[model samples]
Target chain A: MKSKPTACFLLTVVLSCVLVAEGNRDVNQEDRTIEWWTLSTGAGEHDPRTDLNRLIAGEFHEQHPHVNIEITPLHVEDFKKRIQIVVQADSPPDLFQSWGGYVMFEFARQNKLRDITYFVNSTLSKLISRESLAVYSYAGKFYGAPYDMGAVVVWYNRKIFEHAGVPVPQTWQDLLYAVRRIKDAGYVPIAMGGKDRWPAHFWWVYLAMRLGGKEAFDTAYGGTGSFTDPAFIQAGRLFKDLVATGPFQEGFENATYDQQAGLMGDGIAAMELMGQWAPSVAKNNATTGKGLPHLDVFPFPSVEGGKGDINDVMGGGNGYIVGKNAPDETLEFLEYFLSEGVQRRLIEDQGIIPVNKAAARGQTGPIATITGLITKATYYQLYYDQYFPFSVGEALNDASLLLLTGEYTPEETAAAINAAWREFK
Target chain B: MENIKTLYSVKKLGLILLLIGPAFALFTTFVVMPVFQGAYYSLFDWKGIGPLNDFVGVKNFVRLFGHEPFRTAIVNNLKVVLFSLLFQLPTAFFFALLIGRQKFPGAIVFRSFYFFPYVLTEIIAGVIWRFIYNPQFGFLTQLSGLIGPEKTEIAMLGNPETAFNAIFVVIFWKYIGFHMILYIAGLQGVPKDLEDAAVIDGASPLEVIWHVIIPSIRNTIMISVFLSVIGSFNVFDIVWAMGQGGPDHSTETLVTYLYNFGYKRFAFGYGSAVAIVIFFLCLVFNVLYQKYIVGDSRS
Candidate 1:
C-alpha cells in the first residue's frame, strides 16, 4: 500500500515535468525558427553570396538570441521551379528570392504572399527608392523589398568601337551605321543569345517601349487595347530590320547568354544589348579571364518617328518576398538585410547595383551610368517576360524569336501575341 | 480432405493479397490516379493553383489541336520515330551482327566502347554534345577552319532545318548501343547447332543468318521497335538541355512542347490536355503494335 502511493506521487511529478517541457518547447518554437529559401549567386559550394547570406543570418540570430534561422540555398534555375511547387503546396518558406513583377503579382493574387505594406511604410519606404519599391508592390499593396535594381543598356567594347571608327550612337540610324562599320571591320557587330529567347525579346520590348512608351502597355494591360497594336507590330518590324542586317555573330540564334557574353569579352563581338550584370558575366566567361579593359554604356537610341522618350528605361530588380505564413520577424530581418551598411557591403563585394538610396551614391563606372539613367527615367518598364502574365510573356518571347528567324511577319507575330493575350486575359 | 482444401485455399488467398497489395496500391496511386487526375484537370482552365473553378469543357483540347506549336511538336515526334526506325535500328542491327557471335580481336573492347554513351545520363550526354556542336569554340569550328580558311564555322544546331537532326544524332549515339545489346542477347540465344546444320546442308552464311538467326530474334526486334517508338515520342531532356525546343520551336517534340507551352506558361489545364493527348497516342500505338505484331507472332 505504501509503495503504490509512492509510485503515484513520482508519476505525477514526472508527468508535470514533461508537460512543462512541452509547453516551453511550444512557446520557443513559435518564437524562434524561421525558414528562408534563396538562390545562390554562384555555383554550389563555392558561392560567396551563400556565405554572405549565412553570415547575415548568423548575425541576426546573434542579435536575437532566441531565434534560429534555417537557410535553404538552391541554384538559380532550380529555385524558380522549386518555389512554384512549394507555393502551390501551401507550405512556402518564410522568405524566398523573387524577381518582382507579374510573378509576384500571381502569388499575391493567390494570397500566397503576405502584404508587408505596413512594414514598408514604417521602415523600408524611407531607405529604398520608391521606384524600386514599386517593383515589389501589387494591387496597391507592398509584398516585398528589393536589394538590386538594374537597367538594360547597350554595353560596348571601347576598343572595338575605336577600331571600327564609329562613335557612340545617339539615334537608331547611327546605331545601324555603326553595326555596318563594325561588321566591315571583320568583327561581329552584336552578340545575341537567341536560344534563351529572353535576350532576343529584350530587343522587341525595348523597341516597343521606344515606339509607344508606357501608355501603350497600360492601354493593352488595361484591356482597352490589344497586343496587335501598330506600335507593337512596328517594334517587330524594326527588330526584323536589324536582324536582316546580319549584325549578330554566326550561330547567334543557338548561343546561350554565357556564349554571347564570351564573344563580347573576347572582343569577337563589338556590342551586346544587356543589363548592368553584363560586364561581370563577360569577365567570368572571357577566354582571357579579364574581359575588355575599356567598356562603355549607351542608352538604346531613339527611333525616327517614335513617341517614347529616350530617357524611359526598361529594367528589373532582384528581391525577396514574404510567404503568407511568415512570422512578423521576417519583416525585421528584411530591414536588417537591406540596411544601408549591408547594401553598401553587397555593392562593394558582389558588384550589385544597390536599391538603397545611400548605397546608390557609391556606384561608379557603367553601374553609375545605369543608376543615373534609371533615376532620371521618364518611365521605367520591367522586362516583358516578368511584366506580363506568364502565358502572354512566353508568347511574346516565342513570337519575337519567330520574327527574328524570318518565319513570321511582324503582323503574324503580333497576331500570335494578341491571340495568347486574349486567351490568358 | 474438403476441410483441409478450404483452409489451404483461404491461406493461398491471403498470401496472394499480401504479395500483390503494395505493388497494386503503388501503381494505382502513382500511375493510374495521375492519369485520371490529368484527364479531369483537362476539362478546367487552372493555372496549377487554388480551386479549379474555371470549367471550360473540351476547350483546352480544341485549342491544343489548333495550336501551331503543338502541331509542330507532333510532326517533330513523327520525324524522330521515322529517323529511329530507318537509321538507328538498322545501324544497331548491322553492328550487332558483326560483333555478336564473332570473336574478332578487340571485339570486347569495341562492345564496351560503343556502350559507353549508353551508360551516361541523358543530361550529361546532351551537355557534352552541346559543347561539340557549339559554333564559336567547338571542335567542328576548328575542323571547318582546317578545311577552309574562310568557311570558319558551321552552326548546325542554330539552323531550324538542322537542329532536330543534330539532336537525333545524339539520341542515336546514346541508344543504339542499348538496342545492339538486345540484339546480341537474342543472337546468343540462337541455337549454334541450327546455324551449323544449315551451313552443313549447303546454305551460305547470309542465307543461314536470314533463315535461322533473324527468325529467332524477331521478338527482340519487335520489343526494340516498340520501345524506340515510345522513346522517340517522349524525348525531352536532351532537346531541353540543348536548345529548349528552339531557336524558334524548331526542335520541339511532344513532351517538350507540353512542358514549354503548358508548365512554363502556367497553363496546367492545357498541359493536362497535352498529357492526355500524348497518353492516347502511346496507347493507340501500343494497342496496334501488340495486336498486329506480338499477338500475330504468338499465334
Candidate 2:
C-alpha cells in the first residue's frame, strides 16, 4: 500500500457496505466452521473480486445452514505466503485457493491435503472436464478442481495504438516496432509491474514456448536436456532486446503489480502482459472503476523461424483444495461454489475464463479469442512457478528479472534457472 | 582454624554460584544455545517443515559464500554501519552544540523537531519515505520533474545504483535524531567550570569543543557507536518495507538476505547458515570493540 491511492480504500469501504441479496445469507445453525482462503484480485480489504466471493460464500452458508464458510480473501502473494505457513504448520485452513501444480502436489506429498479423488471421479468429473482437474491431481489422485483457465496475452489500449498510428503486431519484430512508435507518441509502451517479477517471466516463458516449442521444456524437465539449452538462452536474449527498448513506466522495477494494473486501468500506459483476469483488476485499480474503454487483447506474437505454433499456449488457472482436517462439508461447499451458476457469475463479472464448459458457452471477443487459442493449442504450458517447486519458480522469476535488468547475460540467465532446477530437484 | 577456613571457602563458592548460576543457565539455554543450535541446523539440507536427514555439511555455507546477494548484503550492512557512524557523528554533535549548549527562543521546539522522526516507528518512516521516493507522482519526483530534463524520471529507489543511497538517507534521517538526543544528554554532563576555564585560557570555540566537549562525551559516543553498528547488522524492517532488498537485491542487508534466501525460499538451512554468519560477525565486532575501544573506562 505504499503510494496506494486513498480512493481505493474509500471505494472498498463503499463496496463492502453494499449488502448481499436477502436470500444469500443467514446465521449458521451448526457448530462446524470452514475457513475458505482465496486469492483476491487486489490485496487486503481493498478487493473488488471479494464481493462476488462473499456473495457465493453467503449463499452457500444460507443453503447449508450447518456449515459456515468463513471467507478470507488474500492478495496473490500474501495468499501464497499465508498458505505456505499454515500448510507447513499442518493446520491448513479447511479449504484454500490453489493454482493446482507442484505447490499443491507438495502439500499432498506432505499429507497436508484431503484426497478428493473419489469425489472427483464420481461427482465433479461430469461437471468439470477431467483434463482440467488433472492439474490438481498428483500421482493419480485428484485434490482439487479448476474453475477458471486461460492464457497470458498482450492487453493493450486501442486508443493509445490509434493515437500512435500503430497497428496490432503479429510478430515479435512488429511488437518491437509498435513499442517504439507508442513510446515516441509520448506514452509508456509497456506498463510492467516489474517488482512482482512473474509478470516479466511471461515474456521469457512465452518466448521460449514460441521458439523452442514444448519439446525443450519437456526434455529439460525430464532431465534429458537442460534450461541452459539454446532455446531458453535465446528467449533471454529476445527478452533482453525488449527490455533495452525501455518501454515500461517510470520506476517500473519497484512498482507492484497493482500499480501496473492501475496504469492500465487509467490508460496511462499502452500495454500490459497478463492473464484473463487483467481487465477486472485494471477496473478495480482504475481511477474511474471502469478500466480502459478500448481494452483489447492479442495473442503473444510468434518469433520468426520458431518451432512453436502461434496457438501453443502458456497459462494456468485458479482453484481450491481441501485441507486434511477439513470437515466433510468442505467438499460440498467447494462443489456448490464450482457449480454452473457461480462459475457463470465469475465469468461474467470477473472476466474469468470459466472452467465449466457450459458456463463458457457464449463468451465473445477477447475472451473467446483466449478460449479458442487454448482449445486449439498444440501445447499448453502452466506457469513455470506453478509447474515447479516454489523455489525453482522463484529462481526462474529472479533469473528472468536479471535478464530484464541487464544484470545477467542470456547464457547466465539460462544457467541460473538450470542451476536452481538441479539444486531444488 | 583450618576447618573454619575450609567452611569459609565453600561458603564463598556457594555465594558465587547463587549469584551467577541461574543467569548462566538461562543464557546458555536461551541465548548461547540457539547460536549453536543454528550452527547445527545449518549443516543439513532442510526445508522448514521436513526431517533433517539430508546432511549436506557445509554445503549451505559454500553456497552462501558463493551467492552474490549474500555478499551484497554484507557490503550493504557494512555501508549502513559506516554511514551511521560517519554521518551521525557530525550532525548529532552540531545539534548538541546548537540546542543543548544554550537554550534560545524555541529551543525546545527545535529539539522536538529534530527528535520527531525517531519517535515514528521504523516501518512507518520507511513507508512514508517510500511514498516520498515514489517514481511517478511522488513528491520528490514531481518536484524534480519540474526542473530536471523532460521525460527523464529520476527514480531513486527504482534504480539499482541509487536505491542503497536512498535507503541510507532514510535510515540516517530516522536515527540521527536519537543520536543527537544522546549527544545532548552527554553535553549536559560536561562541567561548566572546565569549559569556562578553557575559554579563559584563550582557547578558541573549536579548540574548546575539541578539548572539552569531545572528550567528555566519549563514553556516550562509544555506546552510540556500538548501538549503531549492531543495529546496522540487524536492520531489516526499514530496508524490507521500502524495497524487500530488491531492485535486483541492491538494498539487501544481512537480515533481509537471511529472510529472502532462507525463509522465503523455504531453505531454512541456508537461512540458519546466514544467521550463524551474522552471529559470528556481531560476536567478533563485540569482542574487539569491548576489549579495545571500550577498555577499562566503562564507568
Q: Report per-candidate TM-score of chain A alone.
A: 0.91, 0.84
Clashing pairs in 2: none
Model 1 chain A lDDT-worst window of ten: A25-34
The CAPRI-style docking tier of model 1 reads medium
For residues B37-76, what per-residue lDDT tens digits would candidate 2 score against the true structure? 8999999988877678999999999999998998999999
Candidate 2 chain A, which ten residues in sequence have the lowest lDDT sum?
A20-29
Model 1 steric clash pairs: none
Top candidate by TM-score: 1
Q: Please give the DockQ score of every candidate, comma-separated.
A: 0.56, 0.45
Candidate 1: tens digits of C-alpha lDDT, residues A148-204: 888999999899899999999998889889999999999999999889888888898
Q: Using DockQ as the measure, which candidate wins? A: 1
